[model samples]
Target chain A: MDWNAFLLSLKLAGWTVAILLPLSVFIARHLAWRRYAGKAFVEAALALPLVLPPTVLGYYLLVGLGRASPIGQLYEGIFGGPLVFTFEGLLIASIIFNLPFAVQPMQRAFENISEEIRDAAACCGMTSWRKLWRIELPLAWPGLMTAFVLTFAHTIGEFGVVLMVGGSIPGETRTAAIAIYDRVQAFDNAAAGAMSALLLVISLIAIGIANLATSRAGARRG
Target chain B: MADRPTGLDARLVQDAPIPLNARLRCEPGEVLALVGPSGGGKSTILCAIAGLRNIAEGRISCNGSVWYDSEKRINVATRLRRVGFVFQSYALFPHLSALANVMEGLGSGRNGGSERRARELLELVRLGGLETRRPSELSGGQQQRVAVARALARDPEVLLLDEPFSSVDRATRQRLHRELGHLRGRLRMPIVLVTHDLEEAVQLGDRMSILHHGQTLQEGAPHDIMARPANREVARLIDLKNIFQARIAGQRPGAGITALAWGSTRLEAGYNRRFAVGDLVDWVIPSGSVILHRRRRPSRGIRENPVHGRVESMVRLGDTVIVAVKVDAHAGYPLFMSMPVHAAERNSVAPGERVGVSLVRSDIHIMPALQPDGHDDANADP
Candidate 1:
């Protein structure tokens, strides 16, 4: 079943979620409340990954993080390694592609919060940090849960970006989706079918959890 | 109250984001009502006082401290300013219990005695036993009380209520009004109330400011503003509907009367020296001051400003009946008056019936016309 590759996929998804969800909260909050010039442009730029082909995005990231690039040179100077074909590179690719999935739901949730409620919180003598921790985070819980689940599931099932940014390397960057593809090319139909079934079950469970969170949020609004 | 000037004093002027050119002052233990139509900058003024909204040129001072000073380039953050704001929606935290909501205003469980203080505040708002209930579980009035308790927990320098009674039912609003009136006696801070309902302002405000088109037209006692508005716009805003164009005939200082020429009739009003002889002006009188002559016998008091008219329209609303009378000399315009239903019944007042009405002389008020000769045709002799 390529268990090592499956475990590596899980690890990559977990890291992507852990690093992106918290950061998305702040970014989503800023987008929700602020009004400025070119706000729609900024939002469209952030959502570019949703519509662009994964290979296209991967090509840009590959060139940007290659050994000749300034970012790649800086990373090598810090960690003594190039960044294009390792698990870390794959993690970066996963985070970038999952940005829309992580941000849009949380932004909608933050926007649903009444401005009067936030004003009342400030009038109650609560500092901005305390208000965010006590009021905003609790009210936006469902969206956070939805963002976490979707990002994890999407990162695990990613194929094109992973193949482009991080080539298949056993116990390193070879993920479950890549393993299924490799098994099919080798005429190992039985292994491919079993791994595909596992991926389907996992995807269904993640979607179910995400829908549950969304419906709960909808009920609160209703 | 403190010895020095220790209440809210603000003058805000800005062009965008809800235009405002308002000046407000409320002494400690006093309530100032900002009454105007919708989108007239009432709520914007309240927000400016709370530091929730900014102004281009203004200085807001409360309790002898500067909250915002444009000249000095100082603007205090909302939280740092000691202000309690009750929104129009009564925005209580839906997830928190009543006690926790009140405790949140006490620095969110920071003070040593916050819990005890919160409980006492809840009790003060008459929500003692409902401490464990979330906002969703409570009724509208109960939620408003919780919001009020939370607002009071911080012991703010000024209290800003942006139509706190607007969202509740009529009965609940009356009860809240009475409770707020009682609560006002115990509060030692300036309170600014924003409302579009003139009756609510009259009932709650110690002084009222009339705003229109982002400008404060006048500020005075509620009754005074109603009885004697600053201009035609103020009169119209307060719903004083018996406005008419008149020419000043003469001012009898010795008799304490100002004579006005209305069509072919001369009417007497209380002495006002501001308008010179032959000057054109607009005048208004309260609907309650128009007394109908009794059918059986006329009193000497009803002999003043006697004018004959036919009842044009009569509308009965609650305990009062509004009667519009078309004067014989000026048939185009109608004079409106409100009388008790029982009085209307006693006089047999009905549409198409001839009636004699005497406008009370002392109640007539005069102000400059908004548009010169706007309604001059209506007041011409028929």
Candidate 2:
């Protein structure tokens, strides 16, 4: 059943969400609140990976992190391993691909909070951090939950970006999606069906729980 | 109580093309009610004092500490200003219970008795049992009370209320007014109440400042501001509905009555202004100060101010009846007189009936017609 590939896929998805969840919230809040020159350009650049073909994004990441690239050379000079065709490379690619998935919902949530409540919090002697933690976080909890679930599912279901960037090294970067493809190519129908069902079930459970949780929160907001 | 130190002065020019310049001070245990028309920079004054707004060129200080000074480049953060603010919308935290909302205002130094303090504040606002309920679970007035309790939790040095009772029903507003009056006695801070409601301002303020556009037209005791407004606009804003334009004919120096010419009609009013004899003057008498008598019967007091007219209309608002009378000699609109509904019934006054209404000699307040360069030069009172 290619157990190593399935475990690698799960590990990748878990790490991606754990790291991106908090980071995206900060990014979302900054995008929601602050205004500066070139803000629109920066936002559009960040969201490019969402609309770009996954393979195209993967190609850019490959070039950006290849041994010939400055970052790739710096990393190789430090660690003695090329950055491409590695698990770390896959993780980075996953985060970029899922950028908009994580940010948009959280940004929308922060924007929906009334300005009166924000001013009231400031008048109540709350620092910016305290106001965000106490007032904004609680009210935007639903959007945050949606962001987490969408990012988790998107990471797990990823195939094109990881395939191009990590080259599907078995037990290293050969995620469950690659394993299913390999199984089909080898005409191993039973094993392919089993892995596909596992991925399907995982995706379904993530989406189902997100819907249920956000619906309850939505009712409270209403 | 001793005098509370204050030097809160601001001359802001950035909100619009014209600068809003207002200076307000409240001694210890007093409220300076800032009454003005809507868009008259009343709330802006409160916000500027609280450091919630940036003033282009001015200084604001409270209790001898500077909150904002443009010359020194000192601007204190809003939270550290230590001012309690109550917004018109109540601005309660929808997620937090009433107790938590109040406790949140106590900040990090709340110590161990936060719960007790919050409960006591809620009890003070008459919301003891509702402390556990979230703002969404409370009524509008209840939420307003929670906002007040939360503002007071920090024990601020200055209190600013921005039309705090505007959103509630009239009955609830009256109750809130009484509660605010009770609260005013317990807290001796420099309190500022910003409202467009003239009656509310006259009732609650120990001292009243009348504003228009961006300038403070007059500031004095409520009775004085009402009885002797600075200009035609101020007279209209303070609810003196019987303002009329008359040309100054002569001044009776000793008796304090100015002989005024209203079209072809001659009148005597208590005016002390130094304006020239040929200058135009705007004068007002309180609706209640107007005496009404049958046309056949003579006016009891001074005969010069009496106008023989026909009753044009009568509007009954609660206990008072507003009678509009068209004078025989006046070329324009009718004069308005308000009296008790019982008095109207007793006098048997009705629309189209002939009557004699006398503008009380002592009740007449006069000011120069608003200048063309004045902020409110358009002079559309209605």
**Fraction of reference contacts reproduced per prediction?**
0.75, 0.66
Model 1 per-residue lDDT tens digits across residues B1-382: 6577789999999888778889999999899999999999999898888888888999999988999999999999999897888899988887788999999988856465899999999999999999999888899999899988999988999999999999999999999999999999999999999999999999999999999878999999999999999988888888887888889999999999999998887899999999899999888888899999999888897779998999989989999999999889874478988999999899999999999999999999988766775554323211
Candidate 1 — which residues are off by over 4 angstroms? A205-222, B1-3, B110-112, B377-382
How far in Å is the alpha carbon of A201 misplaced in model 1? 3.9
TM-score of each: 0.95, 0.92
After best superposition, candidate 2 residue B219: deviation in angstroms? 2.4
DockQ for each model: 0.65, 0.67
Among residues 3 or more apart in sequence or in different chains, the pairs in candidate 1 whose N, CA or C atoms overlap within 3 Å are none
> After TM-score superposition, what is the CA distance of residue A16 in candidate 2 from its true location, in Å?
1.9
lDDT tens readout by residue for model 2, A1-222: 989999998999899998888898899888887889999998898789778998998899999999999989998999999988998878887888888989989999988887778878888899989998988988888889889888888887788888999987998899999999999999999999999999899989988898898887766644
TM-score of chain B of each: 0.96, 0.90
Q: List, residue by residue over B309-339, the lDDT tens digit for candidate 2.
A: 8888899999999998878987566788999
Q: Among these predicted structures, which one has the highest lDDT?
A: 1
Estimate candidate 2's alpha-carbon lDDT, on a 0 to 1 scale: 0.83
lDDT of each: 0.90, 0.83
Best by DockQ: 2
